[model samples]
Target: MRDQTDTGTTEPIPSRLLLGYARVSTDDQDLTNQRAELHEAGCTKIFSEKITGTRRDRPELARMLDHLRPGDIVTVTRLDRLARSTRDLLDIAEHIQSGGAGLRSLAEPWADTTTPAGRMVMTVFAGIAEFERSLIVERTRSGRVAAKARGVKFGPRPTL
Candidate 1:
């Protein structure tokens, strides 16, 4: 015979489980590899998405974040998978930090936000990402100026 216990007698849930998030920019990009890696990393639940990184809102990502609890870990294949810009990345990091959850990047193990060292590495990465964006903007501006000087007409042609 089996003994019965009160509702509070059940085993407590494991709080350190891994929650994986896999994202691809286009339909052509596959999530197979990322899923496999995340599974191997011991992810109990995996959230996936096929959408542009430039889009500020991602349904799967939001669902994943909502599912996360304190002490739970969020895993991704890469830092870029989490965000397209440094600001977005920082925002996500802040959210995780405030929620008492941890962020882990499989490709970039240094991005684990569970440790002090990981925070430092992410800080540097954020700075570099911002610098790269600035460089791209500057180059685009210079190219537009040069094209204008050369009388290279830009934009669409006017209809007759």
Candidate 2:
């Protein structure tokens, strides 16, 4: 009689787990739609939370990241739900990649990190987002300068 380990390697097959992450900016927003989409996409596990994406300390997101493993894929309904800025997205992507896991966005097909083309697209998107932020900052600074020249006080008004 041949033992199972004698016929093949002792290591078991690595399962490809799809982990979903869903978020809402505020308590009033519902995660139902995101959850439904993730479920339909075949996510075996899901992590969700209601918090501003700008905050650095997101417990659910942290938990999801910690739970990730090799051969796992982190799925999000949209890019905005996962991150508030390009830097944040890049950081999250780095963490996912470091763990040997992949990232995928349902709304943005090009944001997937499992393929070479997808990785290139994500880099391009990050650059675009950064450029857009810089433009907004420059415009805001110009507006501030114009307002200052017009003698508009920016601080709190004097006592009534």
Candidate 3:
């Protein structure tokens, strides 16, 4: 929807449309609380899914992304509920931004990209996550080297 201002300038108004996404890892878990929270957050349309976050394919998430338009906002209860890792989160953020939409997490206010401060915080978080991943990789490589020096064999064991 477009709104015209009195200044004779046709500016696209931010859509009040809040789209909510809620996900649970297992079949035993329920989306009731998430759905309720999303509704409370003024989300007129909510998409719920039950699946592991580690999986690369999330049909509901994909559907929601595809459904978003300019001025739309995507809300989730928590950051983890939206993505499994920093890389994944950044990828999702890119998609949302490219679509001219924003993303917000109820539990993590700093993740709200619609605000300048939130964007800064999210950038810092991304950097920290990347650093942590690098450290992990370095430590893993060091451990492998040490094991090799100790004559530890790599790969599958031979059958007797």
Candidate 1 residue-wise lDDT, 35-137, digit = tens: 9999999999999999999998899999998988888999999989988877788889879878889999988888899999998987897788789889999
Superior candidate under lDDT, 1 versus 3: 3
All candidates' TM-scores?
A: 0.69, 0.72, 0.82
Q: Rank the candidates by TM-score, best first.
A: 3, 2, 1
lDDT tens digits by residue: candidate 3, 12-117: 7766689999999999999999999999999999988999999999999999999999979999999899999888998899799889888999998889999999
- Score each candidate by Cα lDDT: 0.88, 0.92, 0.92
- Where in model 2 is the C-alpha error above 4 Å? 1-13, 125-160
Note the clash tally of each candidate. 0, 0, 0
lDDT of 1: 0.88
Q: Which residue segments of model 1 deviate by more than 4 Å?
A: 1-14, 124-160
* Residue 53 local lDDT, model 3: 99
> Which candidate ranks first by TM-score, i.e. highest?
3
Model 2 worst lDDT window (10 residues): 1-10
Q: Give lDDT: candidate 1, residue 25.
A: 94
Compute the lDDT for candidate 3.
Answer: 0.92
lDDT of 3 at 17: 80
lDDT of 2 by residue, 1-160 (tens): 2235765756665687999999999999999999999999999999999999989999999999999999899999999999988878988998999999999999999899998998998788778878998999999999999999999889998998
